[model samples]
Target: MDRTRTRTRYFTPSEVAAHNTTSDLWVSFLGKVFDLSPLVACFQGDPLLLPITECAGSDISSWFDPRTRDIRRFVDPQTNCIRYYTPRGRFIHTPPSGPRSDWDNDVGEPWWRNLQYQVGLLSEKTRWIRIVNTLTSQEQLQEVCSEETMEEILQRYLCYNSHARSYTWKFDGAILDMSATLMENGVPDDDQELDQLGLDRDTFIPAVLLHFNDDLTEG
Candidate 1:
């Protein structure tokens, strides 16, 4: 038997979920995988690392969405300036005329520039699932089976609804662990249709439930 390990060309959402830690941080944004472990190490103890650390081991796709309301909070409408919260509890506001204002103007590119961290695409076993917010009764049908991970789904869900402050998910009455891979917990990894996951076209898996959280920072 060959002792050499084969590097995976694709990663399932569950697979990505397993690396959510400073020592093994990995996140996917815009279908690209990023191993942020090295970056995490460099930013250790830094406040700048708060956002990334909070999202380690998850899909950051929602974070890059330009339409996301979260960005509006940091922007000064009158000046079109962007306020960046620093690790030292400082605020760095960049005016529209600033060189780095391009980042605020176009959020996706900065995150896309991190492609050097690409690992692989979403695994073939991935499946899309419908997630519902138990509090507001809002629903988002997500392709969990595709390249997107649970983290990504949740992020997008939150971004779409302004009333939703925070959320936590559960499957089969048990809280869906963000750090745990769905594949390991019995989610089928195949090219099957929605029915294969025990769901109908309009009917979703009742196992997963999104619960609102008071802590808005919890991702």
Candidate 2:
């Protein structure tokens, strides 16, 4: 574990209480489970932020790549709706109603319309953008931590904002893995306590354990 990397800043209890982040979004667990800090900081965005440019003159199909395998969609912030495009150059204005039970689940136009209705209640400025690369197979990290390496992960402490929110935290992956093995022997995380109390002990203990383990492994 890299001590320097794990030292990334986190939100304090006061900070967390003050934040009004979206209900659907979640912070990356100290870079443990998910890392979205990178995307949040520097994703090629502004496509969704812009109010749906006059829909009449808008060529929505131009925003999508039909060759991509996954369901390519973006939120129309103006309408507060998520939009998808088809290979035939058509726009889908709705999303699937329930959880996706199958990998190949296909949503019809009716579902798309209903999705639009739901998104309309969300913030008008924030939207999810769909990235596409149809030709070569590429691994775009869906879960990001920082804009660094893919391995040797560390978790992030995210700050939430309610009015402008998306499906998840918007960040890139970092170079540290919180679960990596530590090099030190006989040192347990419980031995150390935070500078403050009242935080979740279970979560804090595991965090300490993981950090200590990484420190040992690196040494």
The number of the candidate with the highest lDDT is 1
What lDDT does the true structure give each of the candidates? 0.57, 0.28
Query: What C-alpha lDDT, on a 0 to 100 scale, does residue 165 get in candidate 1?
Result: 33
RMSD of 2: 19.8
Top candidate, metric TM-score: 1
Off by over 4 Å in 1: 1-8, 66-75, 82-112, 124-219
| lDDT score, candidate 2 | 0.28
Question: On residues 1-219, what C-alpha lDDT tens digit does candidate 1 reach at each position?
Answer: 211133335566777899998899898766667887877675578665677778777876665444552222356476677654233332112223345533454434333355666777766455556676677667676545433435544554566665543666766566554534565445544444665776555543434566777632323
TM-score of every model versus the real structure: 0.42, 0.15
By summed lDDT, the worst window of 10 consecutive residues in model 2 runs over: 119-128
Relative to the true structure, candidate 2 reaches a TM of: 0.15
